[model samples]
Target: YDSCVNSVSDPSIFVIFEKHQVYPEYLIQYTTSSKPSVTPSILLALGSLFSSRQ
Candidate 1:
């Protein structure tokens, strides 16, 4: 898992997950400026991450 946090023009968080053959790679991005709520985006990404493990 590689993560990057940038706070330039638009503050945002980016995550990259490198998986094996059994799982697919996931790129999770969260922007702080555009959206009014960030929980849904985080929850959605986490849901996908956990579900893929099963």
Candidate 2:
């Protein structure tokens, strides 16, 4: 998913995901507790990045 990662402008986050999920099952717990959807968080991240650069 090169396009997806590039779209984020933050491939390292995915890299961490790929490398660091020491316990795969914990991902389930983490996701369950996280925002219902990633869209809002991703939008917030993009907004912050753009705002900071300006």
Candidate 3:
């Protein structure tokens, strides 16, 4: 997959990590438990981690 990553056109998929996180599972459950579509707000909440200075 690493060799093909450069050929891929999708900007959303970059890399896959082996580390697991309960928070990510929680986010998926919360988003999919009720509705099929994942809310943008929930995505923003998850993405906020990268924006933090600390």
Say which candidate scores most in lDDT.
Answer: 1
TM-scores, all candidates, are 0.29, 0.29, 0.27
Per-model C-alpha lDDT, please? Answer: 0.66, 0.56, 0.55
Question: By summed lDDT, which 10 consecutive residues of candidate 1 come out lowest?
Answer: 15-24
Model 3, 5-51: lDDT tens digits are 33456654445444342124343333336547889998999789778
lDDT of 1 at 48: 95
CA error at residue 12 for candidate 2, angstroms: 53
Candidate 2 Cα errors over 4 Å, as ranges = 1-38
Q: What pairs collide in candidate 2?
A: none
For residues 1-54, write the lDDT of model 2, one tens digit per residue.
Answer: 222344465455433344444445444333345547668889999999999994
How far off is residue 21 in model 3, in Å?
56
Which regions of candidate 3 fall more than 4 Å away from where they truly are? Answer: 1-35
Tell me the deviation in Å of residue 39 in model 2. Answer: 0.9
Spell out the clash pairs found in candidate 1: none
TM-score of 1: 0.29
Question: How would you order the candidates by TM-score, starting with the best?
Answer: 1, 2, 3
* Ten-residue stretch with the least lDDT total in model 2: 1-10
